[model samples]
Target chain A: MFSYCSDPETLSGLTWLSCYLTTGKHTSLYLSFGTVLLLLAITAPIALVFGFGGASAARSRFVPLSWLGKAYIGIVRGVPDIAFFLFFVIALDQAFEYLRHTIKCPDWDQPIRQGNDFVVCAAAKLPLGDAPQWVHETYGFFLAVLTFSIIFGAFAANVLYGAMQAVPRAQVETAEAYGMTHRQAFWRIMVPQMWVYALPGLSNLWMVLIKATPLLFLLGVEDIVYWARELGGTKTPKFTDYPHGDWRMWYFGALLVFYLLFTKVSEVVLGRIMRRLTHGQATMGGEAQRKAAA
Target chain B: MSCWDTVADYALRSVGIGERLLPRSDFTLCQQVTLIGSGMIWNIYFGTIALLSGFFLATALAMAKAAHSPLLRKPAEWFIFVFRGSPLFIQFFFAYFLFLSLKNVFPVFSPLTSAWAGALVVLFFNTSAYSAEIFYGAMQSIPKGDIEAADAYGMSGWPRFRRIIWPTMLRLAWPAYTNEAIFLFHATALVFFSGFPATQQMGDALYYANYFADKTFNPFIPYPILACYFILLTLTVIKLFGIVNQRLNRHLPQLQRGRIRLRPMLVR
Candidate 1:
C-alpha cells in the first residue's frame, strides 16, 4: 500500500508491520467487521417483524393459528441452532430452486433429486449457474440472513408473547370501554406498553445475536472468523514476503477482545435505554425512579 | 447388514470401538439413526463432565465475586465478564491454538489439543463463568432477614453462611442454572465444528449429522434425527434438574416452590 511495501524483505521494523497490515487479505478482514455490523443492523429489525407476527398469531383467537405460532416458538428450543443454520440454508435453497424449476421448466422432468444430487435447469438456478462470484457470495449471505432471522425470530417471539401478556388486562379493557375495537386496543394500549417488559429479553437476544456472527463462517460468508483463520495461518517464505509461524492464537485473541468491548458497550447503552423506558411506568423500576426524582 | 447388526457395529463407533469405516453409499435410515445415536456418547460425555466440574468452580467464583476485598472480587468479575461476553465458538478456536502452542513447550499439555480434553476445558470455563454470574445474582437477592435470623441465634461467618446464605442462594439460582445446563449441552454440538479436529472420525452427534448431510446431500433426514436425540437429552436434563429443584425447595410449601421453566437461551 505504500512505497516501503515494495520490498518487504528489506524491511524489518514497525514499517514492515504497517505494510503487512495493509495487505489485501487484512483489508478484507477489516471490511468483514463491517459485514458483522451490517448483519446485526439488517437482521435485528427483520427478526423483530417476524417476531411480532409470530407473537400476534400465537395469541390469536383461532386455534390453528395459535398452534402454528406456538410450534414455531417451540421448534428452536430443544434443537441446537447450528443444526438449523446448516439445515435451513440447504432446505431453503432447494425449496426455492424446486419452486423455480417447476415454474421455469414445465415439461422437463429429469428428477430434481437424482439419488444424491439436486440438479435444476439453468433458468432455475439461484443467481443462475454462470453469474459473477459476487452474486453467488451475496446469495449465500442472503440465505444466512434469512436463517438467522428465522431462528432468532422464534426466540424473540417468545419474549414478545410474554411481554404482550404482561401488559395489564385492565388497560386493554379500558380501551374497549372507550368504544374502541379489539384491534384498536391491541395497537394503542397493548403494543405500546409491551416494550418495557420486552426490553430485558430483547437486549439479551441482541447480545446472543452479536456472539453468533462468528457462525457466519460456517455458512461460508467469509466473515471475520474466516479471515482470522486464513490470515493467521503460517505463510512460509515460498508463499509470501511476510512469513510468520502460526499467529492464529493472537488473531483469535484480538477477535475475543473486540467482542468483549462490543458487548460491554452494548450493556451500558441498553442499561440507559432501560432506565429511560421505565420512567413513570408501573413497574418497580419506575416506582424507584419516581421516588428518586421526588 | 441387518438393522440389529448395524446397531451392533456402530453403537460404539463414536468412541472408535467398532465399525472401522462409515457406510459410504446407499445410506439406510437404520445406519443414519444408529450412527448418529452412537455419536451422542460424546455429547453426553462432554456435557455431564463439564457441568459436574463447572458447578464447584462456579460456586467458588460466585463467592469470590461477592467478597469484600477488590483483590478477591476483580479477577472473578473479569473472568466471568470475558467468558460471558465472547462467543463460545471463538473461545474454542482460541483455546485450541493456545493449547497447540503449549503442547510444543511441554508434551504433557498435548492432550489439550484434542476435542475431548481441550473442548471440555473451554466448555468448563465457559459454563463456570455463566453459572457464577447467575449464582452471584442469586446471592445478592438472598433475603436479608434470613442472615439476620442466623446471627440472632449467635451464628456468624462460616456457620451463618452454611446454614442460611448458601441454601437460599442455591434455591434461588436452581431455575436459571437449569437453563444454563441445557444451553451448555446444546453448546457441546459446536465442539467439532470449531477449531478442534475430531480424530479417527470420533465426534459428537452434529459431526455425524454433518457427515451424512455431506455424503447423501439430503439434510432432511439426518438433521431431524439429531434434533430428536437432542430433544430427548433436553427432556432428561429438565426431569433430573426438576428433581433437584424439588429437593432444594422442599422446605417451602408447594405453592411457593418455583417450577423449572425451560426458557430458550439461544447462546451462552
Candidate 2:
C-alpha cells in the first residue's frame, strides 16, 4: 500500500484500491485460494482411496462386505450432498468429542445431551477450550474436508466401481492363467487398466470438487467466498482505506472467471490425456490411433 | 405437546397450512420427524417441477445444439457452458442477488425473493442445460442406420425427426436423463441454503434439519431423517423413471432392455 493511502482525501482510484486489496484481510483472501487448492489436493486422494476401497468391497466375493459398500455408496446418492456436508460437520464434531469425553472423563457422566445442550467434559473439547484461533479455524476446515471427502468418496466409489467392472473379463482370466492370485490379478492387471476408464469420471468429479469449494464458506471456513463477501461488504470511510461502491458483483464475477478459466484448462488437459491414454489400446481410441498411423 | 399434536400442527407446515412457530422446547422425535417431513414438500416441489418442465426445454436445446446452423447452435452451446461450468451454489446466490436488484426495478416481482419462484427458476435453467447436454450426446449417438432408413423412406425434416430421430434420442438419452433427475433432486436441498429466504419458517427438509440441529445442539437425529426422506424420494424417482425407460424401450427384446444403472454426474 502506498503511504498516500493513509488519507482518503489525497487518494486516487488505483492508489486506494492498491491499499485496499493489499490489506492483511485481502492477503487472507489470496491464501484462501491456497486453502481451496489444499483441500482439493488433500481430499482428492483420500476420497479416491475411500472410493477405491468401497468399489473393491462392493465387488468383493464376501456378501456382507459388498452390501456394506453398496449401502455406503447408495446412501449418499439419495440425500443432497450439501445436506450431508451440513450434517457430517456437526455430527463428526460431536462423535469426536463424544469419544474424547468417554475416554477423558470416564466417571463424569452428567449426560452429554442435556436438553438442548451438547455438553462434553472440559478436557474433551476439540482443540481444547483454550486453543488458539488458528486451531479452531483449522479444525473446522478439517471437518469440512472430511465431510466433502465422505460424500464425494461415495460418488467416486460409484464411478470407480463401474470403471473396475468395465475392465475386460478376459484380461482377469489371462492373469489367472498366468498364475497370479486374485489379489495380484486385481492390482497388477485390473487396477492399471481401469485408469483409462476411470479418468473421465474422475476428471468430472474433480471439476465438481472444484465447484464445490465455495461451499467451504457455508461450513464457516474463511475460504475465498467468505473473504469476497467480507471485503466487498459496505464500509464507511472510517474503517481503513479504499472505500468504494458495492463491488460484490465484481468480486463474485472475478471468482466466476477464475473457476471458468480453471475448468477450461482442465478440459484441455484432460482431452490431451484421453488422447494419450487411448493410443494403442483396444478401444475406439485405439482404432483412431490406427487410422492416424496409417 | 404429544407426538400426535406435533404432527397435527406441523405436518403441512412448509406450505403455510399449519404451525405458527416451530417447536422450541421439549423437542420430541415427532416434532423433528413431522417438521422435517413437512419441509420435504418444498424439496419435492422444486425437484419434480423443474425437472418435468426442463425435460422439454432440454430436448429442444439438444436439438438446437445438433442443428446445422451456427445461429441455432451458438446459444445452446453458451447456455450449456455457462450453467455447466459454474457452481450451482454460486448461481443461487448470484441469481438471488440479481433478482433482488430486479425486484427494485419492478416491485411487482417481489415474490422472486421467495424460494418457490426464484429457486425454481434457477433449478429450471440449471437442469435444462445439464439434461440438454445429455440429450445432445444421445442425439449424436443415435443409430446412423435408423436415420438413413428414415431418409430412404422419404421421411424428411419434421416427420423424420418425429418418428425416427426423436424416439431414438429419447431412448438413448433416458438412462442419462434419469441420472440427471436424481442429481437435480439432491441439488434441490441447496435452495434453502442459498440467498432465498424461507418465509414463515417454510423451508426444505435440509432447512428444518439444520434448525433442529441448531436447536438441539445435536445433529444426530434430524440430518439422518432428512437423508432417509431423500433416499426414499430418490428410490421413488428411480422407480418412476424406470417405468418411463421401460416404456421407451418397449420395442426392444427382453434381453436387450438395458437395466438402468445410476452414474454420478454433477447436477449443476
Candidate 3:
C-alpha cells in the first residue's frame, strides 16, 4: 500500500509494523470490517420487514396464521440460537437448489436427497458451478444474512406485536371517529405511536444483531473471526513470510477488544436513539425526558 | 446392525456409557435421535447447574449494586458490566484460553479446561451477570407501597427486607429470569465450538450433529433432529417457567396480572 513497503525485511519497528499491516491478506481482513457493517446495514431493514409481517400475522383473526406466527416467535426460545444458525445455512441452501432443480432442469430424474448427498444438477447450483470465488463467498454471505434476518425477525415480531397492542385503544378510536378505516387508523395512529414502545426492544435487537456478526464465521463467510483464526494460527516458514507459533490467543484477544468497542459504541448510539424516541411519549422514559427537559 | 442394537449400543453415547465409536456409516433416523437426545442431557446439566448457582450469585451481586458502600458496589458493578457487555462467544474463547494459560502457571487447575468445569464456569458467570442486571431492575422497581407497608408495621433492616423486599423482587424478576434460563441453556451449545474439547467425543447436540453433517455432507437430517430436540426443550422450559410464574403471582388477583413477558437480550 505504501512505497516503503517494497522490502518487508528492510523495514523494522514501526515501519515493519506498517508494512506488515499493508499485506494483501491484511487488506482483506480490514475490508472484512466493512463486510460486518454492510451485513448490519443490509439485515436490519430486511429483518424489520419480516418482523412486521410476522407481528401482523400473529395478530391476524385467522387461527392458523396466528399459530404460525406464534410458532415462529416461540421457535428461538428453546434449544440454542446457534443451532438455528448452523441448521438454517444448510437447510436453506438445499431448499434453494431443490427449487432451482425443479424449475431449471425438468428432465433431471434422480432424487435430490439420495442416501446422504443433496445432488442437485450443476445447472441449479447457487452462484452457479462456473461462477467466480467472490460470487460464491457473497452467495454464502447473502444466505447467512437471510437466515439471520429470518430468525431474529421472529423475535422482533414478538416485541413489535406487544408494542402494537400497547398503543392506546382511544387513539385508534379517535382516528376512527375522524372517518379513517381500520388500516389507515393503524398506519397513521398506532404505527406512529408504537415506535416509542418498540424503541427499547428494537434497540435491544440492534445490539443482538451487532453481536451476531461474529457468527458469520460459523456460516463460512470469512468474517473477522475467520481472519483472526487464519492470520493468528501457528504460522511457519513454509506457509508465508511471517513465522509465529500459535498466536490465536492474541488474535482472538484483539477481536474481543474490537467486539467490545463496537458494542460500547452501539450502546452509546442506541442510548441517544432511546432518548430521542421517548421524548414527549407516554411511557415512564418519556415522562423522565419531559422532566429533564423542563 | 439392527436399529434395536444401535439404540442399545449408542443410546447413552453422550454420557460415555454406551458405544465407544459413533456411528460412522449407514446412519439411521433412530441413531440420530438417540445420540442427539443423549447430548441433550449434557445441555440440561450445564444449563440447570449454571442457572441454580447463578441465581444465588446474581442475588448477591444485585444486592451489592444496590448497597451504600462503593467497596461492595464497584466490583459487582464491573462484573455485571463486563460480562453483560461482551459476547458469550468471546467469553468462551477468553475463558478457555485464560484457563489454559492458568494451567501453565498452576498445574493443579488443569481440569478447568474440561467440558464439565470450563463450560460450567463460563455459563455460571455469564448467567449471573445477566440475571444480576434483571434483579437490579426488579430491585429498583420494587413497589413503594410494599416498603411503606413494611415500615408501617415497624419492620426494619433485615427483617423488613427478608419479608417485604425479596419476594417482590423475585416476583418482578421471574419473567426475565426465565428468559435468562432459556438463553443460558442455548449458550451451552458454544462449549464444543470454543477451546474446550469435548473429551472422548462426548459432545453436545450440535457437536454430534455437526459431526454427522461433516460425515454425510448432508445437513438435512442431523441438524433438524437437533433442532427438534432444542425446540422441544424450549417448550418444556416455557412450561416449567410458566408453572413457577403462576406460583410467584399466586397472591395477586387474576385481572391485575400479566403473562410474565420477556425481552430479547444481547450477548449471551
Candidate 4:
C-alpha cells in the first residue's frame, strides 16, 4: 500500500508493523467488520417484518394460522439459537436445491438424497456450481441473513406479542366507538401505542443480535471471528516479511473492544430512542415527563 | 441395535465411558436420541456447577457494588461491565489463549487449557457477572422501610444484611436469576465451538448433534432432539428455582407471595 512496503523483509519495528497490517488478508479482515454491520443493518428490519407477521398470525381469529404462528414463536424459546443457525443454513440450502432439482431436471430419475448425500443435478446447484466467486460469497451471505432473520424473528414476535397485549383495551375500544372497524382500530391506534412498550424489549433483542453476529463464522461466513483467528496466527520470517508469534489474543482483544464500544453506543442510542418514543404515550414514563415539564 | 442397548452403550458416551466410537452410517432414530441425550450430561455439569459456585460470588459482588466505599464498589462495577459488555464467544477464546500462555510460564496452569477446567472457569465468571448485576438491581430495590426497621433493631452491617437484606434480594431477583440459569445452560453448547477442544470425541449435546448432522447430512432430526433435551432441562431449572423461591418467600402472607413465572430472556 505504501512505497516503503516495497521491501517488507528489510522493514523493522514500526515500518514492519505498518506494512504487515496493510497485507491482503488484513484488508479482508478490515472489510469483514463492514460485513457484520451490513448484517445488522439488513437483518433488523427484515426480522421486524417477520415478527410482525408472526405476531399478527398468532393473534389471528383463525385457529390454524394462530397455531402455526404460536408454534413458530414458542419452538425457538426451548432451544439454543446456535442450533438453529447451524441447522437452517444447511436445511434452507438443501430445500432450495431440491426445489430447483425437481423443476429444472424433470427427466432426472435419481433421488435427491442418496443415503447421506444431498445430491442435485448440476443445473440445480446454487450459483450453478460454475458461477463466479462473488456469487458463492453472496449466496452464503444471503443464507446467513435468512437464518438470522428467522431465529430473531421468533424472539421479536415474543416481545411484540407482549407489547400488543400491553396496549390498553380501552384505547382499542375507543377507536371502535368512533365507528372504526377492528382492522382500522389496530392499524391506527394499537400499533402506534405498542412501540413504547416494545422499545425496552426490542433494545435488548438488538444487543442479542449484535452479540450473535459472531456466530456467523459457524455458518461458514468468513466473518470477523474467522479473520481474527486467521490473521493472528504465527507467521514465520521464512514465509513472510514480518514474523510474529501467536497474536490471536491481540486480535480477539481488539474484537472485544469493538463489540464493547458498539454495544455501549447502542445502549445510549436506544435509551434516547426509548425516551423519544415514550414522550406522548399513556404510560408511566410519559406521565413522569409531563409532570416534570409542568 | 435395540433401543435399550443403544441407551446403555451411549448413556455415558459424552464422558467416554461405554462407547469407544460414535455411530457412523445408516443412522437410526434410536442412536440419534441416545447420543444427543448423552451429551446433555456435559450441559448439566457446566450449568449446575457454574450456578452453584457463582451464587456465592454473585452475592458478594452485588454487595460490593452496593457498598458505600468506592474501594469495594469500583472493582465490582468494572468486573460486571467487562463481562456483561463483551460476547462470551470472545471471552472463551481469549481465556483459552490466556491459559495457554500461562501454561508455558507456570506448569501449574496447564490444566486450565483443557475444556473441563478452562471452560468451567469462564462460565463461572460469566454467569457470576450476570447474576451479580441482577442481584445488585434487586439490592437497590430493597424497601427503604425494611432496612430502617433493621436499623431500629440495632442491626448493623453483616447481621442486618444476613437477616433482612439478603433474603429479600433473593426473593426479588429469583425470576431474573432463573432466566440467567437457563441462558447459561444454553451457552454451554458454545463451549466446544470455542477454543476448548472436545477431547476424544466426547462433547456436549450440540456437539453430538452437529456430528450426526454432518455424517447424515440431515439436521432436521438431531437438532430437534437437542431442543427437546434443553426444554426439559429448562423446565427442571425453573422447578428447582421455584422450590427455593417458595422457601424464601414463605415468610410472607400467602396472598402476598409472588409466583415464579418463567420470564423469557433474550440471550444467545
Candidate 1 CAPRI classification by DockQ: high
* lDDT of each residue in B137-253, candidate 4, tens digit only: 999999999999999999998899899999999999998888899899989999999989999999999999999999989888999898899999988988998898899888899
TM-score of 4: 0.97
Instruction: List model 4 lDDT by residue over A1-294, tens digit each.
Output: 889999887888998888989988899999999999999999999999999889988998899999999998886776788888999998999999989999999999988779999889999999787899999999999999999999889989988999999999999999999999979998999998898888899999999899989999999999999999988888898887777888888898899899889989999999899888879877899999899999
Ranking by TM-score: 1, 4, 2, 3
User: What do the candidate models score in CA lDDT, each in turn?
Assistant: 0.94, 0.87, 0.84, 0.91
lDDT of candidate 2 over B1-268, digit per residue (tens) = 6789888899999999977888888888988999999998998899989998998999999999999899999999999988888888888877777676678789977887778998999999999999999999999998899999998999998999899988899999888888899999989988888778988888888899999999898888998888889889989999999999999999999999878887666645
Backbone clashes under 3 angstroms, per model: 0, 0, 1, 0
Residue range A1-294, candidate 3, lDDT tens digits: 889887666667888777777789888899999999999999999989989989888877899999998887766665577888888898899889989999999999888777767798899999798899989998999999999899889878978998999998899899999999988988889888897888888888888888777888889898887787788677777876656666667777777788778878989998988888777777888888788879
* Ranking of predictions according to DockQ: 1, 4, 2, 3
| Best of the candidates, lDDT | 1
Cα shift from native, residue A266, model 1 (Å): 0.7
TM-score of chain A of each: 0.98, 0.95, 0.94, 0.97
* DockQ (Cα-based) for each candidate: 0.82, 0.65, 0.56, 0.75
Evaluate candidate 3 and give its CAPRI docking class based on DockQ: medium
Q: Judging by lDDT, tell me the better candidate of 1 and 3.
A: 1
- Comparing candidate 3 with candidate 4, which one achieves the higher TM-score? 4
Candidate 4 or 1, higher TM-score = 1
TM-score of chain B of each: 0.99, 0.98, 0.96, 0.97
Best by TM-score: 1
